[model samples]
Target: MRISTITNWAYGVTVGLTLLSGGAFILSARSADHERQAVVESQALDELSERLTMAAEQTSEDARLFVMRGEDRHLQAFRGDENGERDREQALKSFKAAALLQQEMALIQEIEQDGEALDAIEERAVTAYTNGDQEGARQTLFGAEHERVQSDLLTSVRQLTDLIATRTNDALTDAKQWSDFWGAVAKSLLGLTAAVFLGVLYFVLRRRVAMPLMRMTGIVNRLARQDYAVEVLTDNRRDEIGEMNDAIQIFRDNGLERERLDAERRADQRTKDLILQMMHRLQACQRQEELAEVVSLFAPQIFPDFAGHLYVMNDSRTALSSIGSWREPRRAGPVLTSAECWALRRGRPHVSDAAAGDIPCQHLEHADEMGICVPLSAQGDTVGLLYFEGASDSQAIASARLYFELIAENIGLGVANLQLRDRLMGLAIRDGLTGLLNRRSLDDALNRIARDEQGDVIAMMVDIDHFKRFNDEFGHDAGDEVMRRVSAILSETVGEAGTVYRFGGEEFAILLEGGAEGSALDLAEKLRTLIAATPVTYHGRLLGAVTISLGAASTTADMPSADVLLRADAALLSAKAKGRNRAVADWVERSSTDRRRA
Candidate 1:
């Protein structure tokens, strides 16, 4: 039952019991009062009967005295002793008016008649004595008839006294017994009320209210301390405590849910922090190797269950090769061609797991393991790949596919940025027309030679001989074509032996650093002969035989970059002054070798 209902019922029953007990006590008190009143009334009736007997006897005594002594004082005393209108008659009248029992009233009536008969005899004797008939009044006062009348009256008075005493005693005993019965009933009722109170205390308070409350107190305290692990017992009772137990259970459930969410939030924040750190390092990397190293270091921390590789697409964009790897991946190879992986072909993320019924990458040797390939793309162009394999659970990898793709994106951008920077650097230092190192790069090479003491460098300056004749004859396009062919010949003959630069328009410069056994004129003569020997063809027209004059200079010791170039230029002017199709050397100084003009 509900606690409210139980408590209400207890209250009502207790009140009713208490009221009944109080009523019983009230009845008991009234019974005691009635008993005392009965005792008092019985005593008053007994005292009235005694007084009437005394008054009648005294009237007879006073009449005898008046008849025997013939004294007027006796006669007066007879009247005073209640012979006429006395307290004796008044007692009779009061007894007749009282609420007496029928037998007691009969006794009182007998006393009244005996007193009246005695009063009449006594009055006749007194009246005779007062009229001078002494002998007759004396005889009447002492006569047997008078004695019989007086004796009978005294007997009736004594009987009335005995009757009053007997009736009073009976009344007192009956009143006491009745009072005692009611008092015992009151005491028993009070005892029953006490038992009811004690039963309620033991059963209702201790079992129903107190014990459950005690258990709930501990549960509540644990809940207050945020200990959701504490068990709250379910109570099926339809009481306040039962409702409280349910509420506590609910609070514990909510607390557990909150804890779970907080844990996930913390884990998510950790993932974000790792990603942030990886991205920052990526942004700072100057090379693809550095970017790969950054990815290798942080990717495992983000997803520990998987192992992966960082691949960089080769410059031709035809294939991707692993630059770095981490966590000992078992399936994918170190190199993957563009066609070997679907992610590279499609430029998107692809999961490769034959167990999951997905197409596997060709580079994966064993397709039993799950793998995810996120194409590292920037500006819609795939630069590289991030391949993770060895995950047993495909769902695990797929769930975090977004994070993997994000990592791939940043690394791809880094790789693309490095490639772009290298391209830009190449454009800055390379010649646009002949595709040879420009003047700026040649100057830098000479500066390095100047910095290196005890270094020998040979400077050869070659120019196309009458290169403007073709531009004037067949147009500048043919001239441009001739220059391009001559530049290619110079580069091809020099190969790895020296440095070639397009010094200016229709002019070429070469630096030969490694020791050449033949004098510098031989290499210069070979270059001039080759240019003259090769046929030049452009737009279906042969631009005759293209020839070149050469000026060559060699440094024996410390390289003076400016002085050597000036000597080579002066020698070239000398060769032009000598006649066009020939090679010349600086004549002021000579290495102890044969300087033959070719």
Candidate 2:
């Protein structure tokens, strides 16, 4: 039964028992009142019997005194006793009204008859004594009839007293017995009520309520401490305790679910932290090689089950090549064409899990293999490819596919940044018009050579003879063509023996390391002759026979490395001063100047 129902039943029973006990007590009190009334009435009847006996004895003694002493006082006392007979009569009347037993009433009537006869005898004796019949009065008072009547009256009074005493004693005994019986009944009923109350308290309160509550208290304490792993047993009872158990089961279930959610949240946070760390590392990378290394190192940490290669697009954009691989990937090889990878072809992510009925990428060695490819893109241009294979489960790959694509996107951006930086560096160091090293690069080379200070340095400065006349005659396009043709021949004739640079416009400089001055002059003359013999063309027409002035200088221990290019320029100006289209060496110019001074 339900606890409420049980308690209600207990309450009802206790109330009923309490009421019955109360009623029993009231009945016991009523029975006690009856016993008390019986005792009181029996005492009243006994008192009346004693009064009659006393009156009988007093009148008879007074009559005997009047006859014996012949005294008027005795006569007067006997008359008073005779007048007291009315009191005796009233006492007899009390017996008849008391509702005594019929047998006892008959005894009272017999006693009354004997008392009246005795009273008649006493009155006649008193009258005789008054009429001076002292002898007759004495005879009357002491005669056998008087003696018998007196004895009989006294006996009847004694009998009445004994009867009253017996009846009163019987009433007292009966009253005592009745009082004791009802008192015991009331006490028994009260004891039963108390026993029932105690039984309910023990059985219902202690066993049903207190014990179950105590057990649930322990469970609640554990749950409060967030111990969701603790086992909660099922309760099938149909009581309030059963309801509490079901509630506790629900609470435990909720706690377990919360714990699961918390664990998942913590794991997701950890994964995001790793992703953030990888992104930071990727951002810090300066080269495709370094970015490949970073990706290889962190990809396994991020997706341990996957093994793949980082493939970057080649410089020609023709093919993709793996820069790094992790976890011993076997399905995806070292090189893949753009058309071979669906991810690169479609410029998106593609899964190649054959077990899942997905089409395999053409780059995979086995058609039944599982893999995922993400095309690395930046600024709307797909630049590289990420191929992952060897994942144990397709579901694992599917779940982390987003992170793969995210990592690929960031890596693509990083690769794009590296390529852009390389292109910018190349532009900054190369001449835009002639495709030769610019002045800045020449300075950089000179500074490097000066710092190393190894071997003799030859500096050649060359210029096209009257190069602006071609622009005036054939337009600036023709001048540009002359410069281009001459620059190309210069570069081809010098080959790897020297470094060529276009300082500006038609002016060019070359640096050769560790060459003789004679060799430098010879190479300068060869360059001057080769350019003069070579005809130049602009559009479909031959412009002229283009020749060039040349200046050559070499580094000496006494000369600062920075003065070599100036010395070559000075020689070229000398060659120009003498005549155009001639070659001059700074040493030869110096020698001529020395001779002129000498």
- Give the residue spans of candidate 1 off by over 4 A: 1-36, 52-78, 81-83, 86-88, 113-277, 300-308, 313-322, 325-373, 379-383, 387-401, 419-598
Candidate 2: where are CA atoms >4 Å away?
A: 1-40, 64-74, 85-87, 96-99, 121-284, 296-309, 313-373, 378-401, 416-598
Q: Which predicted model would earn the best TM-score? A: 1
lDDT of 1: 0.82
Instruction: State each model's CA lDDT, in order.
Output: 0.82, 0.84
lDDT of 2 by residue, 464-559 (tens): 888888989999988888888888888898898888899888999989898888988889999999888988887789999898898888878777
lDDT of 1 by residue, 1-598 (tens): 8878887887888888788888878887887898899888887887788778777777787788778777778778877766357868877887888777788778777777777787788878777877888888889889998899878877877887787788778878887887898788878878887888888888789988899889888988988898878888878987887787788888989998998889878877898899999989888988777887888899899888889999988879899899889998888888878999988888788888777788988888777778888898899888888988766765666667878887787888888998898778778888877788989998888888778744677888888888888999999889888878888889898888888899998888998886452656678888888888899998898889888898888775443655788788877887889898888887433432335431
lDDT of 2 at 198: 90
